[model samples]
Target chain A: MNEILADIERWRSAGQRIAVARIVDIEGSGPRDPGAAMAVNNLGEVAGSVSGGCVEGAVVLEALELLEGQRDAGITSFGFSDDEAFSVGLTCGGTIHLFIEELNW
Target chain B: MSSIYESYRDALQAEEPVVLATVIEGKNVGSKLLVFGNENIEGSLGSSELDRVVSRDALGMLEAGTSEVRHYGVDGEARQDDLSVFIETHSRSPQMIIFGAVDFTRALAAQSKLLGFRVTVCDAREVFVTRRRFPMADELVVDWPDRLLERIGGDLGQRDAVCVLTHDAKFDVPALLSSLATSVGYLGAMGSRLTHEKRVDRLRSEGVTEEQLSRIMSPLGLDIGGRTPEETAVSIVAEIIAIRTGRAAPRLSETTGHIH
Candidate 1:
């Protein structure tokens, strides 16, 4: 989140709606631990990353859906443990639980 | 309108220690409590009692520079799992105070930065401890080791480190001695095995307790066959990590065959 603050602020200044995907939990050998986060704007721009490139693409889709109003902000799971829910899985075979939410705190 | 994100971003950008405790599972999932060091809190976790307990725990986790998900009851009871709060800490980075401006210092400083440590290079000799010599160091102090520590020792805590790389007794003794006076997490000295043996005797003469002497990882760094300064820097950081994580620094080659 710290690394992406500049980008987030820039997008906000441009009046872009933003969604945040934060890793709330991880099981087994995860590349990034809990608290890892990524942000996606309505334009599909991304900042930060929640995984080692494996899950960011999927996270971007989730963020876009949340922004599109087609999906509600809530918990989203990815990685091998929840492969049924997500087509993508962490290459390291760990499960990561993320909370997708609008930056409307 | 002001929001918890505004305060959290402000505190983080100021490099102040802060914790963002968020409810990720259960009622009011996504509710947040922004916790500061002095028990100053903003936002809520849907219940004041839950906010109180979570803020207290968040401050503790912030001090330790760790983030994790913890379970609690609706009102923050210990034995229930009705809610999961992701207590994410944005503590100030750990500090690495290097007490030499040698070739190894530059490498070690860069390595420490890679591990998210705020690096400080200190040496009494102004000629070597230059900003040009160690451009990556967050601080370059040209002062006596003891005096420098005197100004900053109280701020050192469990996540801080002190590395005395001055092999000379004149500088090494005061460096390691002053380091012992602090609660820095890792204390190490760089030298050969024989050199550290002589240092141990000198330290004993200075009345350093056996327990304090034992805390020093002399002949610093893991036995990773590191020959170059860069490789040695890796070994030293690896040793610091192993010590911090309470793990044995065993070479993977040596850990086979079920010797344990």
Candidate 2:
């Protein structure tokens, strides 16, 4: 979050409604730890990352849906689990739980 | 309407220590609170008693720089799970104090910044310790290592690191002694076998105990056979990572290990 603060500020100043996705938990061999964050603006502009390139595309999709009011702000999980809720999975075989929410607060 | 967010943003922008506590579960879902130092909390957990207890616990967690989900009774009583509060602390960056300001110091400072450390490049020689020389460093302190450490030693913690790149005994001896006095987790001194041997003898003469000497990584960095400053910095950072994880620095393919 600290790393992306400048970019977030730039985007916010430009009047971009942004969604922030923070890694709340991880299971198995995660490339990044909990608290890793990625910010996505309504324009699809992105800053920072929650994973090692994996699941970021899905996160962008989620952020866009959130901005569109198609989904509520909450946790999104991605991994190689058999549940198959998310098509994109981490190559490292780790499960990451991300809390996706608008930057309203 | 913007006061809470503004305060949070300002604190984050200034790199001040703060924590955002959110009611993630139970009755007051989405309720928010802000905790900073020992000040009165800005928001509530739907109850005065819950706010008081959670604020106290949040301060302790902020000091340790930890984020976790804590369970408590509706009114903050223990041994109850009526509510779950996620206390996410926004701590100031862990410090990396490099006591050398040499060529290696430049690379190390750059690498430390990449790792999200607030790097301070310190050396007694004002000529070498200029900010222009190590622009990547967060601070350039032209002072003796011992003097600087004496002032800030109390703040040093397990997450912090102290690198003594001054191979010269004149600067390194005092630097090592001062670093040893602090609780800094990684105390690395850059040197070779002979230089480390001589340094050990000098440290002993200065009343540094064997236990304290063992804590210092005399021949700093892993045995990666790195010759250049940048490569050496990578090796040193890798060593720090390995030390923090308590893993034997070895090639993964060569050994059967848990692969943490």
Candidate 3:
């Protein structure tokens, strides 16, 4: 979050609508811990990351959908599991829960 | 129309501690509550009672510098997992105070900053303690170690560190003694085996007890066989991380352990 603050500020000043995806919980063997954040503007530009590159592309898609109102802000889980599986699973075999929301308070 | 992003950015830029609580599960998905010291809060969860309870828990997580999802009752009742709140804390970065502005100190300060520590390089010698020499350090203090610790020791916590890179007995003895008074988690002094023995004797003569002596990591850093200043800096910072995480760091191939 600290590293991407300048970029966030720049995008905000240019009046870009943004959505944020934050790693809220990790089940096991996660690459990044909770609080790892990624931001995506309405233009689809991204800053920061929540995973080691495995789930980021999927996360950007989620962010754009949230911005477009196609999907409501909520938790999105990505990983391989018996119950459900994501196409972009974590190679480390951990389930990460991300809270996706717009930048609006 | 104030955005949470603006509040978060302002808090971070000013170095003010803050925490963001998001309702990830239950009735109010994506709802947020911003919390600071005490019960000062902005925004809210769906329920007033839930907001109160979650704000209290957020402050605790902020102090520990932890981020996690916690379960709670819908209206803040206990023992009922009706809601999940993800509390993300923005705590100040841990600090590293290096008590010698020597060659090793420069490398260590740079490495410390890279590892997210706010490094402060202090030395009594005015000539050696210059901001130009340690551009990576958050601060370059030209003062005796004891005096510098006196001003900032109260803020030191288990995550902070104090490294005495000055092998000189005159400077190291007071530095180590003053550092011991604080709760800084890692206290490392750089020296060779012979220098450590001589320094130990000097510390004993100065009336430092055996218990206090054990707290210091003389011949500082792990046994990584690092000879250069840059390599030694890596060893020291690695040791700090291992110590903080309670990990007995060894070569991965040498031990069978659960990697978390």
Q: Please give each candidate's TM-score.
A: 0.92, 0.88, 0.92
Candidate 2 docking DockQ: 0.38
Please report, in order, the local distance difference test score of every candidate based on alpha carbons.
0.90, 0.86, 0.88
- Number of clashing pairs, model 3? 0
State which candidate, 1 or 2, has the greater TM-score.
1
Among all windows of 10 consecutive residues in model 3 chain B, the one with the lowest summed lDDT is: B1-10
Error of 1 at A38 (Å): 0.8
Chain A fold similarity by TM-score, each prediction: 0.91, 0.93, 0.92
True contacts kept of each: 0.61, 0.14, 0.86
Backbone clashes in model 3, listed as residue pairs: none
Ranking by TM-score: 3, 1, 2
Better of 1 and 2 by DockQ: 1
TM-score, B chain alone, candidates in order: 0.93, 0.93, 0.93
Predicted structure 1, TM vs. truth: 0.92
Evaluate residue B244 in candidate 1 and report its C-alpha lDDT on the 0 to 100 scale: 87
Query: Which stretches in model 1 have alpha-carbon errors above 4 Å?
Result: A81-86, B250-260
Worst 10 residues of 2 chain B by lDDT: B1-10
- Complex DockQ, candidate 1: 0.46
Listed in order, the DockQ scores are 0.46, 0.38, 0.71
